[model samples]
Target: MRDSAAGVLLGLACGDALGRPVEFQQTASIQRRHGRVTEMLANGAHGQPAGTITDDTKMALCIAQSLVESGSFDPDDVAGRFVEWYQSGPFDIGILTSTILRRLRNGDAWDEAGIDEWKHLPEGSNAGNGSVMRCAPYGIAFAGEPDALVTASRVSSAITHADPRCQWGCVILNATLAGLLAGEKQPLTSALELAADAPAELRTACEAVLSIMEGSESATDLELANSGYVVTTLQAGLYHGLTAESVEDAIVEAVMLGGDTDTIAAVAGAVAGARFGASELPDRWLRAIDETAEIRELGQQLDTMEISFPESIVEKLSSGQFDLQA
Candidate 1:
């Protein structure tokens, strides 16, 4: 479990750092330039040093560290942490996340802030991968506690995305990760089933993976849209993450598709990481991410966290007037 948790964070960071340089490049251009993109390279999209992770890994580290220190899903504390990180001036932050975090810093309650920000945006543009990209940490912390994991996943996403698709996207994604950590045979579908009220679109989206794993659906059979939309990113990431034979293959394949490569690969990396465990991750990739050590320590902390669904967490979930999953 510890290794699996570590693998989740490590794989996320590895993917973020590796795909950072070539984020929006065309697949043809990526292939022509770097071929498989096995090694980290400098100066492409963000122009950072090689091995530098972007917002995907950085924001996830915030969640993982916040969980370890608080030992519970405290949204306010997490919000404060996010605001602090935002104030630190990150190199990259999703537009929705930035607007919401700015609101949080300006004294809006965590629950109200993101929803309010989400309300001002157009429909399709509102649900984004920002929350889902950094949400895998909840899977480890709440591994065996499915309800707690679900609540955390949705609420954490509600910190920046209020769309049902966006919130449930995090739920199914983390639920799947939690299932994998617990050794569920049919992790993805099983997790979605656990959420009896999961959106049909998300359920249908995630269910596509079963056919994918069963050899009935080929990569060509599926239209893998590598976009910032929460659903598509989660779908593409899961398809690559579950189908790939290895952790390296999962991340590389997702990145090779181009267009939001870092985020797509980061999501894939987390899923593959959970399946393969930390020890299976390449050391070269691990050493490249600056957050690797902290993530490793946080993974160990999460592995040892007592399995308790505190009433406080439960109350927080039910306290909000807006039904996040609805």
Candidate 2:
């Protein structure tokens, strides 16, 4: 369990670092400049170091630490942690999320933070990959209970993103985590089919992903997948589910995919790490991440908190037989 959580955190950070350099660049541009971006780079738009992580990894650790500390999903605490985290200014955060979190800090009710209405911002204001990026922890924390996973994902995402697409993206990630933790090796198509009964908005996004992935022959076939919350999250989960032969392979494949690379890698790494555990992660790669001890401590806390769930559930989760529908 400790190793699994460590793998999840380390995978997320490594992916973020690997993807940071080519974040918004086209694949051709990235290939032209960096030649595959297998190693971490720094000082792009943010002027950070080689192994520095972005909001994707930062927010994921925040969520993991919050859940580990509280032992359950607490939106208010999560919001508080997010605000405090941003105030410290670790990475680039999205405008909508920053605005919503600021409002929450100023005493806005959780629901009033523009959770249910698209009109909360402009027409296209709601659907970034921010929510989906940090959502992997929810999947890890609620590995056995689909309802709890979906509900906690909704709660965590609603603090910033209100679009059904964003929320549903979280659901897919959580479902992926559940399946991965359960040791189920269903194809991406079959796994998504299990979520066919999800909300209409989510189903639509999943259908779009299905179309892109159905006939894919090469890695580039995934380029058709969008970087937005809906498409990117599903693509990340699918790629993580399909391509990963090891933890390092998962992180590398996710980072190399290009669009929304950091978030995609982070989300994919989370699921893959959970499925494979820390021992499967390369020692050199794990040693390369920034703040390894902090992330590992957070992982320990998360593991300790698993005691809140029933013992049988925890055992099944550790054994990779936890039921997703449960």
Candidate 3:
């Protein structure tokens, strides 16, 4: 239970790296080539090392570090860190995230950066799983305060993603993970009910998640969409995570769904991690993630964060007075 933070973070990285090699392959190909992909293997999508994680874990690490440093949701700091990471050249990055960050680099303010970008992109491409994939750190840091969790999740998402589904995607995920960390017996349900203020689209996707968990809708029947679309990814990821019997099986099943495999598995891994503590996560999977030690350390730091929210930051966030230089 106490290891929920480390479990969620490390679980995400493990899932990302495990699925890295076979990201775009169909379920049949995955089953035929490697039934139950349990170990980290090299030469898949990006042709990196066996334990190499993609941008999902890397961006999460950035968010975790910013939260620890600021002791709150510092949107500016988070934005700057993302810009820095983008400049450093990550191997894998979502299209929306890259577009928004590039605009940020070109002098768009943190608060204003994503608005225009989101406006130009059409529906299917606008709401991507980018924000949701890296938002677990906010859940860990704000595990005690649901209101603050929602605010942080939504605001930080504007650093790159501004769509309601994208923004509420983070809200739903972080809220659920926060509840799990707080030891809610029915964490996901608690989160959904608590997030009643979230957009209806988010609720619809979340209802799909429950349907999967209730065993009434088969994964195949539920139309497990593994695309980068936020709603589909959320549905499929949570379906696999909440429905599977074990952590390994959950991650494997999500990745086996094919497209957007790493991100889907990352999201599923976080949900499964909350359900089963860090102790339940396989040592082999942990060892396989190259940043395992960093993930554990960062998760611990976030878990123990003594929240000291000042009125000034809240005012700035609420009034839309975010400082890009902060």
Q: TM-score for every candidate vs. truth?
A: 0.96, 0.82, 0.93
lDDT of 3 by residue, 215-294 (tens): 66655667777788888888777777777898888898888888888999999999888878777888988877767888
Best TM-score among the predictions, by candidate number: 1
lDDT of 1 by residue, 1-326 (tens): 88988888898888888889999898999999999999988889978999999989888988887888887777788888899999999989999889989888888889887877777889778888999999988888888787788888888888898887887888888888888888876688777687667678777777777787776776577888888988889988998888799999999999998999999999999999999998999888887777788888887788787644568767655776645646
Task: State the lDDT at 105 in candidate 2.
Answer: 70
Judge candidate 3 against the unseen true structure and give its global Cα lDDT, from 0 to 1: 0.83
Candidates, ranked, lDDT = 1, 3, 2
| lDDT score of residue 95 within candidate 3 | 81
**Model 2 alpha-carbon drift over 4 Å, by segment:** 187-201, 204-223, 307-326
Candidate order by decreasing TM-score: 1, 3, 2
Best-fitting candidate, scored by lDDT: 1
- Candidate 3, residue 197: Cα displacement in angstroms equals 3.1
Say what the RMSD of model 1 is: 1.5
Q: What TM-score number comes out for model 2?
A: 0.82
Off by over 4 Å in 3: 212-220, 320-326
